[model samples]
Target: MRPEKIAEANEIDARVAGALYMILADYNGMDMPTTNELKKSLRENGASFNVVKNRMLNRALSEDASALLKGQTAMIYGDGDVVEVAKVIKKFTAAKKKPVIKGGFVEGKSISAEDVVELSKLPSKDVLRAMLLGTLQAPCSQLVGVMNQKVASLVYVLSAVIDKKEQEA
Candidate 1:
């Protein structure tokens, strides 16, 4: 490859390094159409996958990107819906008898295949977000109930006072 071509490849690889790191960091490897299929599915689902050259990918993963490239930085590729990426990889692996997870960088740490399995077990971002919303709303709902009860008690007291005054008159 010419020096310029090599540089360009390296640039692309570097640009995708974060993505690759995310993939390998979250998954192992896939079989033929399964891999391609998964990649396609991810793209359709608002994510992406890439089969990048190791040399270029490695070049992109310099020490600066190490935090996100911690463990197996050499082979990694994917971007979008960080959690969804992992979930799709997980789903494909589960469906295919032999699609194994490799490794990946998560939040600047390198993780193993087993670690990726654990990642797969996690609920998606939306699920977590919903859980958070429910958690927040629970207390607010309880507060509203408590406030309404207090207002009802005041109303009852006033009603009783009016009833007694009318009887006395």
Candidate 2:
């Protein structure tokens, strides 16, 4: 490889290494303006959209990831929320009807295109955390209510006994 090619591969490798997740998509038939808009949207959502040479990308990726690269591939990757990134891509694909999803890598595993769509359908991290919080608090809240009910029952019994004694007297 030429020195410039080697540098490009190294840069791609560094990007891949740092990413928490990556989505590969077909960028065929996308105009420059449309592609720039997609890149901007992804950037705002804390991900990057890069149209790299497939050969260079292959050099950077693991063997499993390399298999997904073919014909005008662009990589979307970030260290932030994977679901959010996937959502952005899904939205863009729906709006423009370009850049069809290929496949992805999440954590350390390669996933199918369907898996990428499924990931986009998932709730954001904040929403998922809120759901988990609600689940945890449910039991505690119920326990508190049950304890309060027992105390109230005891108090009611005590009050009734006092009234009965007073009426008898």
Candidate 3:
């Protein structure tokens, strides 16, 4: 390969390295239109997909990440929520049954295709935050309710005592 071409490939690899997740997929036997559609879908969701030579990809990725690359491979990388990107890919694969995921990594940890699919099924960060907030607030809410009930009971008892004293007088 020419020096300039290698430089360009290295640049692309470096760009992908900054993303939160890197997915390696096999696009073998997939039609051009389908692949283009997948690329467009990924692009719409803040991801870029490129067909990468396995050798070049292997060279670009870390040792652990590179182990996931083999055969005909394409790369998907995005700075957005990795789970959301995984969801998009999962949905696309379910519909098209092409571009099978070989493996991937997130934040330097290798993950299998099944792991990616499971990640896709996870709730978004916001939803998870909401759930945690609700859990944390539950006890406090209950504590307030208990305090209110005790005050109401004390008021009731005092009112009864005052009514009895008035009747005696």
Candidate 3 local lDDT, 86-111, one digit each (tens)? 88899999999988998887887788
lDDT tens per residue, model 1, 71-116: 3222434554556666676776667743455565665566767777
Residue-wise C-alpha lDDT for candidate 2, range 1-169, written one tens digit per residue: 8999788888999998999988889999999999999999899989999988888877777765566877889899999998988888889889999889999888968889999889989999999999999999999999999999999999999999999999999
Best model number under TM-score? 2
In model 2, the worst 10-residue window by lDDT is: 58-67
Name the 10 consecutive residues with the lowest summed lDDT in model 3: 61-70
TM-score of each: 0.71, 0.92, 0.85
Using TM-score, rank the candidates from best to worst: 2, 3, 1
Question: Which candidate, 1 or 3, has the higher lDDT?
Answer: 3
Residue pairs in steric clash, candidate 2? Answer: none
- The numbered model that scores best in lDDT is 2
- After superposition on all C-alphas, the RMSD of every candidate to the true structure, in Å, is 4.6, 1.5, 2.2
Model 2 vs truth, CA RMSD: 1.5
Cα deviation at 156, candidate 2, in Å, is 1.3
Error of 1 at 107 (Å): 3.7
